[model samples]
Every structure is written in structure tokens, then in C-alpha cells.
Target chain A: MRKLIVVLTLCVISSLALVAQGTPLPDSTSDSTAQLLQQAHALYERLDLERAVPLLERVLSPGWSFGMTKAQRVDAYAYLGASLALVGSADSAARYFRAALERDPFTDLDPRRFTPGQVAVFRTARRQTFAVGARQVSALRFDPRTEQLSFTVVTTHGATLRVEVRSVDATPGQVLFQGESDGLREIAWNGLMADGRLAPPGRYEVRVDGRSRLLSRSDSTRVYFDVRHELPALEDTLHELLLSELRPERYPPSAATGDLVKGLGIAAGAFVISGALADGDLGSRSSALPATVAATAALSGVVAFVWRRHHAEAPENVLANARRRQERRLTNDAIQRRNNARIAQTILVIAPASGVGP
Target chain B: MRPAFAHASGPLVLLALAAGAPTAAGQWTVQGTGVLSVMRHRVDAGYGVEPSSGVLAGPEVAASLRDRLTVRLWTRSGSFHADGPGAIDRDVAEAGLQVDVAALRWLTVQAGTTRRTYLTVLARQPWTTVALGAEAHLPFTETGVTGIVRGAILPGVSVNGLGHPDLAIAVASGMEYRRGRASAAVLYSLERYRFAPSATATVERREQLAGLVVSVGWSLKR
Candidate 1:
């Protein structure tokens, strides 16, 4: 009887102790709130917001330590708040907004989206939020005479800035510059791809992404592109000019040749007329002079015909067609360059809701 | 019966006037010709007859109607020293009309009427002649050297309104040197005449008239 009572008491205490373990476990082996938050995000992306809300709530539940970085925590609460709001529980969403700002005082939402009025309840919570803004990389210009191209980026206070210069076409070129810098960052590019060859004339994009560590929830990024056209060398230009002159168009047979044909015809006709007038009486004299003049005319006519045949206009047409093909190729390249120059980007600002005002 | 000279001369004048018009093909052409000929008459032509050897100067006008046909008008006048029995000073006028039809590129058929009238002694006795002929041209590729042949049959001869079966013929062969619109040719032609017995002349008279005609011609077009 005594042994039985002791065993039963031991079992009861063990049951009570296990019940006293305050935090909830996701499952038997883990209480990782980050994994739970990731699962909830997947559910939210899948449009199962109702299911995602419960998972997000579990991450914020009492006695559960969601060991996430400052950025990660802001992201989690923002995801939960957004999911709760999507599920039509604005009141429940407001609590997560307040809790996010308690972690990072300058917390804000993506300004372009989720306007402050959308979460008016969080607007009162964000009294001490930090400002977030970005500057165009083109503010830092390179010297015109130098081969190197330099640029700079400016971010908000205590911000982490990353700048990159990449080809606008995005596929054929290598990263010309990529690095992290302080709130005020400066970079130089040698105008060459990773292959060490001088970059061809083309469009290139400069991108800057920034986040202030002092205020994890406020972040901004800017992207824009520029076009460069490299002029040809003098030797190349001269060579092309000479090459164009090499195959001269001789057809449409020049005006001088046409005049030659007309003049020859006239001379032949004059010989024929002269022969006619020089004809004499047939008594004792033979008519040899007229025959000689006729012979001169016949020979002249033959020469004129030969000249007309050799100077025909077909070769000029062939050269013209070749020139047209070259023009089309140049026009197509210009259009491609114009299209690249039209590259567009929208500035992105990333933030989340903040805490309620004290 | 009308005089044969009047019959032949009327057609000649008509041809001469018709050639004065032009055509639309731009191919209408007129040709002026000068011919100097030497002639020999076969028999003595009685009173005031021409000499055995005589010179005939003829001037002609010819027009080709497009490329297919040609019409020519000619007049010849001659003066001869009388040399036969009871001869006297004499003159003769000959007028003629000739038409040529191009039967082929190489061949042409011709017909003409000619009348010869004595101006002095035998003025009342005018002789008329009718001719049918064909000409062939053999052209060389050189466009200058050409061989020509002509033959004619004279079916009848008329004098003072009377017709005679004279069995007369004419033939010629020549070489020509030609250029576009211009040519020169020299040919020898033989014309034969035969007359039946008459009240005043008992035996038949056969006369062979032979001549070398030198001709130069030019084409004018509108």
C-alpha cells in the first residue's frame, strides 16, 4: 500500500511539473518562434491568412522567446499585423503594430503602401520614428578626362548602404561595382567588366539600398540607369571613309561619257554628209573619196556603240543596295540604344508599423 | 481614136501631181533625180529624124509612199542633127510615168507609160509605148554594195491612134553603191522597136535603141 501511494504521488508531481513548463512548444522538440513565423509567412503567401494568423499569434504568445534579429522581428510583427488586418481583426492587428515599435522606436511601414491612415491606430504609436530617405548615385560624378567612373550614395543616419553598378541589359555584363558602405558611401568603377576589357558603349544601372541599424524598420532604395556612347577613333573613321571611296559608283554612266557618245555620233553624221557633197561626175573619175568618208563614219559609229555598252548603270545600283543595307543596320542599333535609354525603376521604401505613443 | 501621146502624158501628169502629198508614218519621201543618157535609134525615122547617135537629158521626180510603193514622173527633151535622107533640124519630147510595187524585200514589179512626140517635121506622128517590168536587188551585208537587174516587156506600140504588135523588150543590169537615202548607179539598157509593114514603108522595121543612163538621186521627207 505504501509503495503504491509513493509511485502514484511521483507520477502526480511529474505531471504537475510538466504542466508548469510555461512556454508552449511548436512541437515536442522545438520552441523556435522564427520557424513558426516562417511557416506563417508561407501560409500568408498562399492566401491562407486565417491559418497564418494563428501561427503568427503563437510566435508572440507569452513566455515564448522569438530569438530574431531586430530586422527579422520587425518583419515578423509587420507580417502578423498585415495578416491580422487582412482577416478583418483591426483591433488584434493594432497590438502587433505597437509591439513592433517597442522593439525599434523609429519603425514605420512601407510609405508607398499601407499609408499611415490605413493603420491609424499605429500612427499614434510612432511618435519617435526615424526618417528614411535615399539619394541618386549620379550625385557623385567622375572626371571627364579620367578612365575611371566614380559615384556616391547618401542614406539616413546610421544607415547601412550597398551600392552596385550593373549593365542595364542585365545579362551580358558583369557587376562593375558592388560593396557596402556607411551612411555616406563613395565608390569608383574603372569602366570595365570582370573580364578586364574596356566596357562597350551601352546603358548601365546604379542601384543603392539602405537601412539604418539605429532604426531597423526604416529602409529605402533607389535605382536609375545612364547611357554612355564611346566615340570612334580617328584612324577608324578615316579607314571607313577610304573604304567607301574604294568602290566608286561608275554607273548611271557619268554626264561626261554621255556627251562623248553624242559628240561621236555627230562626228560620224558629219562624215556621212561630207561624203555626199564631195560626190563628183562619173565620166572619168571613180567615186573613191565618198567611199573613204563613209568608211570613216562607219568606224566612228562602231567606237561610240562600244563606249555606250561598257558604261552601263547596273554596278551603281549594286553599290546603292549595299549602302542601304548598311544604313538599316545602323538604324537598328540606334533603336536598340534608344530602348535601353528608356529603362525605368520605381523607388522602394521598406518599413513596418510602430508602437503606441506613451 | 485619141492620140497615144495624149493617153500616156495624162497619166504621167497625174502621177507627178499625186506625189506632192505626204503621209502620217513619217516615212513619206520625195526623190529628185537627174539622168544623162546616150541613145541610138534602130531605124531611120524618115523626115527630120534624129541622128544615129544622140544625147537625151532627163529630169525626174519620184516619191515613195511609205515603204511599199513608189511613183515617178519624168520628162526628157533631146535635139539631134538631122543625118538621114531629106533630113531636117528636129527635136523630141518624151514624157513618162512609172509605178513600182515591192513584191518582196528583194523584188519589185513595175509598170510605166511613155510617149515620144516629134516637135519638128513628123509632129503629127507621135508614138506611145507601154512597159511591164520587174527588178531584183541583191544586197550585201556591207549595206553599200548591191547588185540590180531589170527586165521589161513592151506589149504594144501606138502611133497616130493605131496599135501595133511590135514584140519589143527592154533589159538592164547594174551595180549600185548606196548609203541611207543616197545612191549612185550606172546601167546599160536596150530598147527594141518593131513596126509592121505600112503603105508607105513595105518591109518591117526593127530598131534597137541602146543607152547608158547615169543617175543620181536624193530623198526628201516631211
Candidate 2:
């Protein structure tokens, strides 16, 4: 009796599922809700808001039949608003975002996405209080490439600052100081030696000093001097920056790729050994299989040769051209650097000594 | 239909394992909540609430290592409770890292590895909530080196790859006229992902998924 009941229950459940599947989807006329969402997504992906706004407005219309929860409605509003702002519709986007926030207060909506202009004002104000103490110094490293010398300074306050090309080793020496109000700075070198002539590509020492009156900081300074070489392109410089910023916990695979490769090799070896063991009759079959094996090998060789011939062709000719362009860009950048260094040297020589700041 | 439930059960067990684990501070955070689509379609009946779609919810945890370095781990599990054909659901997790090297006052360098569960683009998107399993970003990486420069021309670029059936490459570049609480950045991203042959029968029919996303954001804190 119990078995029969269980069987009946199963049958009923299966029948219900089948019925549900057979039932037609909600009517197309009632699909304005989904249509609105599709339109919004399409517009957002295309980076076009001009066409998406009116469609979204119609979908949000009160009479429109969309079976959406209050929360989902709020999300739609937020996304629509954000999309509008991205395409230069700030006022309208702000209104939508604010409306969404009112509907759903829990949303961690990023205000920054809505207001690009306001961010500049905020940063300027914070720059006024920018001051660093000696205790804030954590670590510092220097890198010199074919184009510029960069200094990476890590601070205890979770800030990483950089200084670029403070002085060139060549003639008519010029120094460039580049610093940010947010504890970041750089200095450039203009191909001039200390004696005011073109300097050789070699090592040089750089120094930085800072004092703030509001913080009552005097003589609280940190200094680092390191050897750096110039890089060929901005790409190379950027690559160096990425390598320096890799954190172990955040990017463990980057640090462990070597180990992973070794492990894969070991696993492959084990698979081969197991396959050999499984073919225990290999000794008996060797003589009989020699011809077959050779034929198979020959066939595989032919196939591989054909594949190689076809695969050897470049898949991306455009990419090859792009690479050539990149090389040219690098060359141009080097030339620019050299010319800038010469110009700086001329300025240094011609400028009045009294114009120098302390 | 029964098999789908069994397939869905596996992720549920994993979720139970994660939830049962002891909570740790700085190890977890309420990242955010949103809805994700199971598949892309032209027309449907409802709007906001997707009874047949998956409900996306999860936590994100970011921790610092040795002051200058930080690591972040996040997971999102979405499930749909519906009866009938085409009921869809999935769960995903990701981990990534960020490092800051201050060599100058104006530029800082950053680099790191990321697993499938931690792609930022998928996390930031409103629809398609499945955390891009194989997507990782080296946001400030140029060549193999990562660094930043301050003053005059503040330039940066990054290379990213998506894991899984679609091994895609994305290159991004950004410029910031940064000040204090108010800094504006214009970021441009281009991505290309190719689908596998085996994916023909599934919803992943497109041989390439290419798009561009440009975003500008600002923040204010008390």
C-alpha cells in the first residue's frame, strides 16, 4: 500500500511538471517589461543613451503590465539612470538614481558613477592637507629603463607614490619634479650631466624633500637614491609597473605558475606510466606491432606536417602591423625624450641664476 | 528535469559548506545584491521580478598583506526556484590581488593574479550575474611590468584574459585628472572572447563576444 502511494505521488508530480511545460509562456502583448529591459541593455552595450531613454520611460509607465517586484523595479531605475549619466545625461541620470535610492535605501549605489565633475572639487580640497612624515615611509625601489628612471615609494598609510626621470645623465642638466597632492610625485631628467653637457647613460642619485606648516612638520623628510635605465616604450614602463604591484595573496597563481607547470608535468608522467602498465602485453606485441606502429607514426607525421603548414600562416596580419606601429611609436618617444632633454639644457644655461628657487 | 535539480543540488551543498564556516573580520563583506539573466532573449512577459531567473546574492572579502599589498576574495551563488522546462541557475567564486609600489610622489605600480571567480566586469554589470569564471584583470599592467607615474601626462594601460571556453583578451587604458575627493577618470575597455566547439549545443553559440565599456565614477565619504 505504501509503495502504491509513493508511485502515485511521483506520477502526480511528473504530470504537474509536464503540464507546466506545455503551458504557453505569458502573452507577448504583456511583455513590455522584458522588452524595456532588453532595450536598456542594448543601449548600454552600444554606449548610446539617445535611443534608450524613451523606450525605458515607456516600460516604466504605470499602465504597462510588467510583473516585477518593487526591488527589481528600483534596480531597473538605477541602471537606467546610470546608463543615461554615462552618455552625458547627468541631470536626468541623477534624478533616476535618487529615485531608485529612495525606493531601495539599502543599495550601495556609487555616487561617483553619477558625478564626474564633483570628484575634482573633492580631490582639490583634500590636496591642501597633504603632508607626509618620516614614519610614513615603508619601502622604496628604483627602476631605470631605456626611456626613463622611476622610483616606487610605498608608504605606511597605504599609499604608493612614483617619481619619474628627475635628471638625465647628459649635458646642460635639467631636473623635472612631478608630485601629487595625494602623496605621489615624480621627477624627470633632461639628458644633461652635472657639468651642463650631454651625460653618458649611467647611474645617478636623486633626492626628494618636503615640509608642511599646518602639520608643524620641519625637517621630517625621507630620501631614496637608486640606479635606473631608460626603457624603449611606454608599454615597457607600464609592464614594469604591473610587475611591481603583484601581491601574493591577491594573485597567488602569478607567483606559483612555475610550481603549477611542474605539477602538470608530473601528472602527465604519471598518466603515461599508468598507460604503459595497463598495456602489460607490450613485450609480446612489440614485434607484431612494429610495422603497425611505424605506419601509424608515419600517418601522424603526415597529418602533423600538413597541420603545421597551414597553422604556420599568421592568423592576425593586422596585429603584426600593429606591432610594427608600436615599435615606431617607441622610436618616436625616444627621439622626443632626447629633444626634450636638449631643450631643458638650453633653458638651464640661459636662465638667470637669481630665478632659481630655494 | 529531474537531472537539473540534481545538478543544482551540487552548488547548494557547496554553499552550505561556505556558510557553515566560521566568520572572520576583514575576511568577508556584504558586497551587493542584484539579479542576473539565465539566458538572453528578445521578448518576455515580466519586468523586474524574474520568477524563472536566478537570484544573485553573496559576500566579498578584501584583506591587506604587509601594508603595501592587498588580497580580495568574493563568491556569488544564484538559484532559481521554478517548475517546468528551462529553469536556470548557477554559482561562482573568484579571488584576486592588488599591490602598490610607490617609487614617486605621482606614480604607483600595481600587478597581481586573479582566478575565474573574481572578474570585475561581471561583478559590475547589472545583468548576466554569473561571475565570469575565467576572467582576470591586471588593470595597470603594461607589458609584464606594472607601474604608475604622476604629473604632466599620467598614463596607464592593462591586459586581462578570460578563462573558460572563451579565452578572450581585453586591453584597457585610462587617464585621470585626479585631485582629492573629486577625481575624474575616463576608462576605455575592449574585449574579445571566442566560444568552443562543444558549446554549440548550449546557449554559448556565439564564436566571439566583443564589446566596449566606458565608465566614469566619483565618490564622497563622511
Candidate 3:
């Protein structure tokens, strides 16, 4: 007799499920929401509450539609309420159940299917979504070592969300994290900036923004994070900065080349002039005066040619050359030695290789 | 009297201008040096008796544009009596330009030309010579004292084809003390002048002079 009764109950449950499925869901149902509801139901049957509860809550709270048929609406509310009750949100479950009845008084709640506490709590429901509650967000905790930032957002319904880290003045902002809550009660961020870098240590405000059909809201939390490095690293950074400053800003390789060529030409000019001058002084030894004078004239012509040659340098280039000279003077060996001595205290050096062991 | 002032003044003015020029330009270099040398000379063949001894002293001032080119003006005079009636004497004033290339860490090669006015009792005969020279330096321990070797040979013509047509070879070995751009050296040198036969002097003549030279230098670059 018991077996027969159990079989009858099974048949009734199967028909109820079929009837729900065959009811021609609302034409306005978004394919996405339909898929989510189907997945939630499957997970609930498999007892994957960790995954199913959020999906059911998402389908009910924000995914719920006024355009849905009475059957569809009842399905969302009943499933969401059952999921919430299973997760121990008895009061919230009852609230959703009452919200359904407010829309359609003929809503059915099976006592045999739901816990006694859920039934008792359901009796206290007053209105639809309006009574679900105000939107609230709180930062759970931040762990600097793990770089994990955790937070919770409770919304009366599903919301599109955006998260950011910004200066106290709300300027210098960057997006930190964002997503549809998908009924997720908690969020954890690995404390990475958009570029996946651990943000430099400073005071910054974390902002969470939510927008739903009925309302839009934002909440902020302040965090000050510090990243510490060894003294050697700081020293190395300073050394590099100083080295960079000491480096010549402009390398005018061609500038010196032309000057060097000019110098060579000048030396050659001096050489020939010296030669002609000597010849003129010794002209008394022979009557080769005309020949010597011609040679002298030729040398003079060369000198004139060299002297007439123009050297063009821009005004800025001249200044830059002077600046480079000054920088070069700064590297006098003695001064460099002294500066190196002063900095050597902080330079970490590995021991040199020793001779073979005895 | 010889225009001792003229001979002295030209180099003096060059040095003054070189010194003043660098000071004005703010980056040129000037180096002044004074050398005192004791010399002994030998006549290579039948021309004279034994040997002669003399003193040579000079001052050199060089102006440089950076590290590449240098213009140096110098003057030196030496007088000595032979065993017989005559004296072998020379008083010279010259200006030179050198292009130096550092060939190694402790060595340098230089090429240059010199205009030399050789003073005689009759007149001053000027000569031009081009030379290739090499210099090597060695540190004596870490005490900042350096040993130096310098050698040069003039193989080119006497300019205008009228002056001493001789191959002049000079070599000096020295020890120097240097600090910054200033240095002091005590040197010994052997200098040889081999003259080709000319219309005025028929016989080929070779004169070799060995000398001890002491010099001190100071630079304006620093």
C-alpha cells in the first residue's frame, strides 16, 4: 500500500513539472534568463546549492519580469524561495514568496514541499519587490599580503555593476573590477590594477556602482595600501636616477667630428704657414726670391681658403655643447672617486670568486 | 747685436696670446715648459779635433685645441769651442704644429712640421723640417714617477730647397714626475745631424750631440 502511495506521489510530481514546462513561457522572456533558469533548476536537483542559489536568486530578484505569465512568475518565486530557504534566508525567502502573491493572489505555496519556518515567515510578507529592501554595500576585508579585496553588495534586485579605485577627490580614477552581480552575495578582488600591477602604496577610495531598472546607486570604501621593498632596491633606484641625470641628454656625434676635422685643417694650415715663413727668412741665401714668394703666395692662398670656410652652428647647439662641457667637468677622476666612495656603503656586492680549495 | 729680443719676443707673444686666448674661449689649453740641457758634441770625421762641450737652454710654449692638435713655439741657444780655433755655435728659434694620435695606453705617435731660424755670425738661416715621432711611457711602480722614451726622425726636405738638407734624428730617455697637468722630467738625449753635400759645404758632415736635459711643465687646461 505504501509503495502504491509513493508511486502516486511520484506521478503527481512528474505531471506538475511537465505542466510547468508546457505552459508556453512568456514571449518576452530573454533567452539568457531562460537559460539561467534552466541551469539553476538542474544544479538544484543535483544539490549544487553553492552554484544554484545565486542563479535562482538572480532569476527571481532582478531577472523577474512583470511581463511574465502568472505561471512563469510563480515558477521563479517558488524556486527562488525554496533555494533561499535551503540556504537559511528564511525571512528573505518568505519576502519573495509574499512578493509573488502580491502580483497574483492565486499563487500556490505547498506546505508539504516547504519547511515550516518558511511557511511561518511567508505569512508575514507585505508587498512585491518594493519591500525587498534598500541597496547596501560593505567591504568585508582587505588582505595586503594576499592582495585580496573582499566586499558584499545586497540589492533588492539584480543590478549592473561597475567598480573603481580613485583618489579621495574622485579624480585620478581607474576601473578596478566590474560585472553583473548574478546574485553573487560577495566579491573578492586580487588587488590588481587594470594593468595587473600591484598598485603603488597610497590612500585610495574604492567605489562600487549599481544600476537596475528601478534605481541606481553607488557606495565607496577607503583603503591605504603600502608595498615595502628592501633598502638596496631604493638605493638602486636612486643610483639609476642620478646616473640618468648625469648622462648626456644629447649625443651630437657629428658635432665633434666636424670640429675635429676643422682642428686637423687648422693644424695643417699652421704647418704650411710655418714652412713659408721659414723660407722667407732664409731667402738671403739665394736669389730664388720670386719662386719663394710664389710658394708663399700659394700657402697664403690656402690659408685664405681655409679661413674663408664657414662653420655653421645653431644657437641651441652651441648652448648644448657648453652644457656637455660642464657635465664632462663633473666627471673629474678625483671627484668621481670621492662620489663613488660615498655611494659604496649602500652597494651590495657579491664576494669575488676564490682560488681552488686546498 | 742679434735681435735677442726678437727671437725671445715671438715665442713670448705666442705663449701670452695662447694663454689669453684659452682664458677668453674657456676651453683651450696652454702648456709652458723650460728646459736646461748640458751637451757634448763630436765631429764625425777629419774636420776637427777631439770633442766639444756646451750648454743649451730653451723655453717652449704650446697651445692646443683639445687633444688633437698642438702649436708650439720654442727657442734654444748653444755655444762651444772646438779644440782648435773655431767655435761650433747655434741659436735657433722655431714654431711647430703637431698632430698626435694615441697609439696605445702608454704610447703615442706624432707628425709635425717645424720652422727653424738658425742664427750664425753672418745671418740667420731659416729651415723647415717635417718629422715623425713616437713616445712611450712607463710607470715606475705606483709612485707616480714615469719613465719616458721619445724618438723622432726628419726624412723630408728642407723647405724651399735652400736650408740644411740633412736627416736629423733625435732620441731621448727620461724619467718624469707628473701631477695633474703639470710634469717635471730629467732626460738624456742623443741627437745626430747628417748633412748631404751642398755647393756651400762640399764634404758630407755628421755631428752627434749627447745631452742631459732637465725640464718642467705646467698646463693651463686644468
- Model 2 TM-score, all chains together: 0.17
lDDT by residue (tens digit), candidate 2, A260-355: 332233223223322332222211212211232223323333433444344443324335455655776787788677766544333211111111
Model 3 earns a TM-score of 0.44
Q: Write the per-residue lDDT of candidate 1 for residues B126-194, one digit (tens) a residue.
A: 768889999887553233545456778887577663337455777654445667667676555556665
Candidate 3 residue lDDT tens string, B1-222: 333533674566456445534455555578888767766555443364335566766677776666555666666665544433454455544555566666776787878876655455656656667888987765432234555566788776373323474557766655566687777876556556666667656666555555566778877873
Instruction: At residue A169, give the lDDT of candidate 3.
Output: 33
The runs of at least 3 residues in candidate 1 whose Cα sits more than 4 Å from the true structure, single-residue gaps closed, are A1-358, B1-25, B44-51, B82-89, B120-123, B198-202
Collision pairs in model 3: none
Give TM per candidate.
0.36, 0.17, 0.44
lDDT value, residue B222 of candidate 1: 65
Candidate 1's TM-score reads 0.36
Candidate 2 chain B worst ten-residue window by lDDT: B145-154
Q: Which stretches of candidate 2 lie over 4 Å from their true place?
A: A1-358, B1-95, B98-167, B174-191, B195-222
Note the residue pairs that clash in candidate 1. A101-A355, A106-A129, A108-A352, A109-A351, A125-A355, A125-A356, A125-A357, B42-B207
User: Which tens-of-lDDT digit does each residue in A1-358 have in candidate 3?
Assistant: 9999999998677556645765322233454566667766766664667767776666666545534565566677767776777778878787777667545433545789666766655554422232111122232333434445554443334556666655343365666546664233455555445565544433444555655534444333233322222122211111212444443444344543443343333334323322332222211212132233233323433433343243232444446556765665654555666655553322211111111121
Of 1 and 3, the candidate ranking higher by lDDT: 1
